[model samples]
Each structure stands twice: as C-alpha cells, then as structure tokens.
Target: MSRIGVVTFPGSLDDRDALRAIRLSGAEPVALWHDDADLHGVDAVVLPGGFSYGDYLRCGAIARFSPAMLSIVDAANAGLPVLGICNGFQILCEAHLLPGALTRNEHLHFRNRDQWLRVEQTDTAWTSAYQPGEEILIPVKNGEGCYVADPATLEMLETTGRVVFRYLRGNPNGSQHDIAGVRNAAGNVVGLMPHPEHAVEALTGPSTDGLGIFTAVLAHLGTAVPAASRDRR
Candidate 1:
C-alpha cells in the first residue's frame, strides 16, 4: 500500500484529518514530524494546512527551515509526489518548489466556507483523478489564501496550463485569475489554497468533491477508483 506522509509542524491543524483521509482512500497514512530528518520511505507526502509557527513571520516563512522540509525539498526534486494545501502551499512557495505566493485575502478577513472549484487541469499526480473542467466544491479556510505572482510567472502558468484548480462561482480571496491551485512544471508537486481534507466524507456535505484528490493518490498506488465519482469529468 502507498504510505502517504502527513507532515506535522508545531501548529498543524489538519494532520490527523489528512491521515484519516489517506486511510479512507485506501492508503496507509504515515505521521511525519517537522523536526524529523527522514521521510520513512513514504510514497507521497502531504503538507497539511495550519498556522505553523502560529503564522508568525508570515505564514509558512518560519516553518520553511524545519528539518523535515530539507528532505522534502530533496525528495520533491527527485520526483516524489507532494501536495501542499493552504499553509502548505505557502511553505512550498517559500521553499521555491512552486512559483507564486499566497497573500492575505482581499477582504482582509479569514474566509471559511465551502467553495466551488473547477478542475482546470488534471495532469499532475495529485489531481489525475479529476478530468478537465470537472467542477467540485471543497472547504476553503485561510486568511492568506490569495494566490499571486509576477506577470511573467502568471503568464507562464496561463500558457502552460499549470493552473490546476480554479474558483468557480466566487473568488473568495481575490486570487489572481481565480486560481485555487497550481502544479510544478514536472507536475510532480502541487499546491493549493483549499482544504480538500475537510470534504472527503459524505457527512461533511457539499458533496464528496475532495475525495478525488485522495483517491487519485490511491489509484497511483494500484488501488481502484471509487465508483461514485468514476466519470468525474
């Protein structure tokens, strides 16, 4: 089975939830601490959302130097699948693995709600279960969820189809081009500003829109895709 590593930083909020999601998706969830120097040979890594270092020094800035991140960077560069959600996205940008930055919401308030998103592109390891143009709703919560970048980077993302998920109905955080997620050039690393871990089960309502992401990883591990969303395109 694919052992997915969920990295836990000092103030991580969703490590458990991420682990549970991995298990529900039929993969073994491995606990990885920020201070650890090893990845335990996990198949994939998930940087769960949270206010690491209490969001001090600007979101993921302080957490960037955490020991675990060093190995993560090396592993990611070697083509290990890595998914960074919300604050995790911030860390990925600070780590220079992904382009662009996540800034404070235009509203200047922490937004928490179920959001509609379109699978703009799905060629990456984390989003392969989704098809082009598939629309889904997952919960988004963060004060710094606004995605931004220089014109050149934005242009590159637009032209190369690296923008993976996009806000559908409303641009809650006023992100550039309504981008909810993006992938690295090789498509092995993905970072997004929403919490897919919160929408995996039916009890969470708003549909099981986020399960495809977890299942996508599971499918890569030799598991079959769930029938409920088989044709999610």
Candidate 2:
C-alpha cells in the first residue's frame, strides 16, 4: 500500500485528521515530524493546518524553516505529491514551493464556515478525482487565509490553469479570483486554505466531498505519471 505522510509541527492541530483521511482513502498513514528530515519513504506528504510555531513570526513563517521542510523542499521539487491545508498553505508559500502569499482576511476576523468550492482544474495530482467545474463543500477556518500575488503572477496562474479550487457561493477570505487552492507548475504540489481532511467524513464534516482529494492522490500514484509527461507550466 502507498504510504502518505502527514507532518506534525509543534502547533499543528490537524495532523491526525489528515492521517485519518489518508487511511480512509485506503493508503497507509505515516506520521512525520517537523524536526525530522526523513520522509520515511512515503509516496506523498501533507502539511496539516494549525498555528505552527505558535504563529509567532506569522502563521507558517517559522515552520517553513523546520528540519522536515528542508527535505520536503527538495522532494517537492522532484515531483513528489504534497498537499497543504489552511496554515499549511501559508507554509508552502513561505517555503516558495507555491507562488503568492497568504495575508490577513479583508474583514480582519477569523472566518470559519462550510465553504463551497468549485474544482477549476482536475489534471493535478491532488484534484484528478474531481471533475472540472464540480462543486464541493469543505470547512474553512483561518485568520490569514487571503491569497495574493502580483498581476503578472495572477495572470500566469489563471492562463496556465494552475488555479485548482475556487470559492463558489461566496469569497470567504477575499482570495484573489476566488482562489481557494492552487497547484505548482508541475501539478505535484497543492496548497489551499480550506481543510479537506475535515470533510472526508459526513458524520463530522459538511460533506464527504473532501475524500476525493485524498483518493485522487492514490489514483495518481497508481498511474505513475512520468515527470517528463507532466506540464512544465
């Protein structure tokens, strides 16, 4: 079975949830530590949400320099599938694994709600289980969840189809272009402000829609798409 690693930083609150979601998706859940450089030979990695490092120097700023992240940066660059949720999204940006920055919400309040998201891109490793334009409900809770980028970078993301999930009913945190999630140029790395792991089970979450995000990776691993076959941008 494929092993998916969930990295737990000092303040990570959702690592267990992500591990459970991965196990439910029929993949082995591997617990990874923020201070460990080894990935444990996992096929994929997930950075769960929380105020890493007590949100001391910004949500994910401190955690971005952790030992594990140093190794993750190299693996991610080599096309390893990596998913980041909520504060994890902030870390991805801080690590330069994904473009743009996550800033405070326009309302300057912690927004928590079951958000509707449209799957804008399905070719990505983390989104292939979703159909283009398909809508899903997932929970979003954050203070610094607003995604921002320069005009040229935003245009590049839109034009190259890197925007993955977009807010549907309403813009939760004033993310640009209603972008809730995005993938790296090679489509192996994805970062989003919503907690898909929280939505994998209908009993606890808004819907089971989030299961697709985890299942999609399992499927992608099964296919073993070559790095040369992936889109360059």
Clashes of each: 0, 0
lDDT agreement of model 1 with the native: 0.89
In model 1, state the lDDT of residue 233. Answer: 30
Scanning candidate 1 in windows of ten residues, the lowest lDDT window is: 224-233
Residue-wise lDDT of candidate 1 within 132-216, one digit each (tens)? Answer: 8988889999899999999999999999999999998999899999999999998989999988888878876466778789888
The estimated TM-scores of all candidates read 0.95, 0.95
Predicted model with the maximum TM-score: 1
